[model samples]
Target: MSAPPSPSSPRPRPRRPGRAHGPGHLIGAYGLLALTALLVLIFSLALPRTFPTLDTVDSILSNQSIPAVLALAAMVPIVTGAFDLSIGYGLGLTHVTVLQLVVHDGWPWPLACLAVIVGGAVVGVLNGVIVVFGRIDSFIATLGTGSMMYAVTGWITDGGRIVPGPQGLPAAFTDLYDSTFLGLPVPAFYVLALAVVLWTVLERLPLGRYLYVVGSNPRAADLVGIPTRRYTVYAFTTSGLIVGFAGVLLAAQQQIGNPSVGLDYLLPAFVGALLGSTAIKPGRPNAIGTVVAVAVLAVGLTGIGQLGADFWTVPLFYGGTLLLAVGLAGYAARRRMRTGAFAARGSPTVPPRSPSSSTQDGGTAGTTP
Candidate 1:
């Protein structure tokens, strides 16, 4: 078959840098490495007595789960170029709903948890429908939904906390957050497992391509036969489901459901999501990056707490980091586009064909039709 199709003219192999895909990805990965080192150094010096200890590490891992979960919830919709402001509010309502069901309504704990999770998913689908059908911006849609959820929470508990009675709730349910496995906190394991599963879904599946396409150019994706609206709905639904699970964890962890505590989680969750777009996969909302971003914030906040910094400082730090991360993400995206375009221009192109009129002069076309 034509001398085995010419061994010297084999298909071009994709260039790889070590274990990573390319120079761009390697740069992103290295940036995360540098950031992790910087965080460790800063925390080590700031909380010299406690920051480096295993117990401190365990504490950070333990306390960070809820925020990390919420951050991931926010990040999901972000992959489709949308925002879910309802997550924080949803958490508030979900916890209260679960607690009320258990304590006030005398429902089983597992059923209460399930009902709340389903409610979150329903809310998420509603958000998606409002955005998709009503043509409302995702930010505005989620904002309105969040406000409604907040009002519902206030109505449910009359703006008071819901604490489980000793006989009403099972101790095993509380242990979902408090227990440890193999010397590590259970929440940490759950976070790791969830992150891994989400990473696979986002990075190694066609669903991810659809999300990227929808986010980057929804009209174009639609034109290319991708069901952008369906994918958008899926993103919001997944986000809502995750947020519901996070609320369950919150209730379990704190052993009480208070509407007041949830709104405080919003800023840090958004900060983690935005900060994630700057590392590990710069300009993309990646699972590993989100977790790492949450870890960085946890470590920093823990160190500050240990150093007796006031509570207000945490919000200030989160807001500042978010602004910085947005700037970095913008810069990285633009730079990547420019470099890609330049590289494309430098590559070879096939020659254009001349008219067949030359064939009359004993000239034949060499190019395939």
Candidate 2:
């Protein structure tokens, strides 16, 4: 038989690159965005007079801003591999606190807003402590804390609304949520600004990288000397602060403290956060993706409503979309892990010892004898 090829000889080229750049990759990256655009096109064609108007755009922007903010809040914790279930409850409590201070105690709107924001930070710190120091599971701890917050909200509001005095909320206060800037609602601008800031922090900053590392593998992060617990707490605290700001905006928009409204946002916030993972940068929570996901939901819901869909249809759509988003997120995450594993396995193997080299060594020894 012919001698085996030398180990140093060139081998056949790999049929595929080490990395895949196929349709599946593109689909994972831009599928949601493509769907969003397609939905807009369909809705515009179906309801040319209504769906494509500035009014619809403004309504979607204005109405979805709070959920967008809350979704971002939820996203911060998720980046560190934790969840903050208390966001909705904390939102209700914080806004109600704002209203109680302003309408009931005659505190100025600005000062009341300041107090609520600080209180939100405090609640966030509390959550971080409970989760990090107390060694409680984030989901369960936040859920319990959230329930307590709802109870506090009920106690403060006494199951009643807190309406502003006859003078009405300061025009400036309401304008925060009501006014337009560059033809877009101020809240829309707020959403954009927040997303930009978060994107910068999470994508450009070292802290963001640390958070991602911790989320990806806490044990690996710890092995690398990263203070995972401290960062985790920081993530939770940041989430709280953002949620608190959303509460302020909610107060401005509603102009009344409705203790029941916060929970309405929780599911939608989660849906946006989870769906966000499958876009922008697939398989991880990202700020821009969260904003885009929220926009998709707003567009879809608006389109359905314009089609004369019943009120129940709205919840059904949200519920179904939420389920789809969760499944996709989980699938994407597992897919990423599998891809990494395969890449590791397919890395260049060590060359086998050549038979020609062994035969040459044996001949040289025999000749010497």
Candidate 3:
């Protein structure tokens, strides 16, 4: 018989993260970000004068700011394993209401903005109720609520654009989007600020931990004494709040209410959130990752726009990238299947309800549904 090995003798060690996955790991973590830089390089070289200019940079940052914020807004509910398709519709309703109050009812812009934001939170609560209590799939529930919200948007606008009267929107209100900060557009700062806030809440707070638990595996979370239903509601509510804030920015930027505007943002928002899940922290959605995803998209769109591509190419690009992101996310998940490898996820394991339990550390089946 073969001798049994001594306890002190060497054991087969689990492969360390970088060594286990090698180039695959690095590419999964940073491929999209690297692509962003590469796109800039290629475009700058191809269209030296126009593509590399500060004016182009500023315009891309400014124009893409709202979309980035909207992407962040869309990401909140996704953490709780729920989807809020209503954000675009909610955004439409809130912004039109803002203009209606400011222009027609003569309400102060600040008051109007506040009211819309609160209304958004309420809408989120409604979405949560429908999803959690009503037991409808989140996709269906949010879509239904979103359709209703869109209808309300048209009703308030009376099927026409909501234009300001002679006095126009308070210059201060318009400046919310138009002003500059640190030599860059204020809206860009708004995106950065929102991203930081989300990162803190989702990555560094107990509330975020609970929401992630609920989303990653509601059944497991329930077993572990996490308030799965409550956190799901909170996730929806947070998303609604963010969407409302985005509407305020949209109002300031457009300075005119166009009901059709919200629908256009929905695709890009999802694209960023989904595509972002494949980079910087693949297989899970994150704030900084989402921001980087949006930047990649912004760079690509801007470069293509300058390249004079046909208009239809915009939707084609979004749709294609989304498919690619989904596939890449799946591949990343497969590559990381041995997640129990301590070094792979880069977070310490804790009991499910622990204060620092990152979603990535969920030792449960609480990943994407």
The TM-score values for the models, in the order shown, are 0.88, 0.88, 0.87
* Model 2's TM-score against the true structure: 0.88
Ranking of predictions according to lDDT: 2, 3, 1
Clashes of 2: 0
lDDT of each: 0.83, 0.89, 0.87
Which candidate ranks first by lDDT, i.e. highest? 2
Clashes of each: 0, 0, 3
Residue pairs clashing, model 1: none
Candidate 3: clashing pairs of residues: 80-215, 216-366, 217-366
lDDT, model 2: 0.89
Given candidate 3, what's the lDDT at residue 340? Answer: 38
Q: What is the lDDT of residue 85 in candidate 3?
A: 95
Between candidates 1 and 2, the lDDT winner = 2
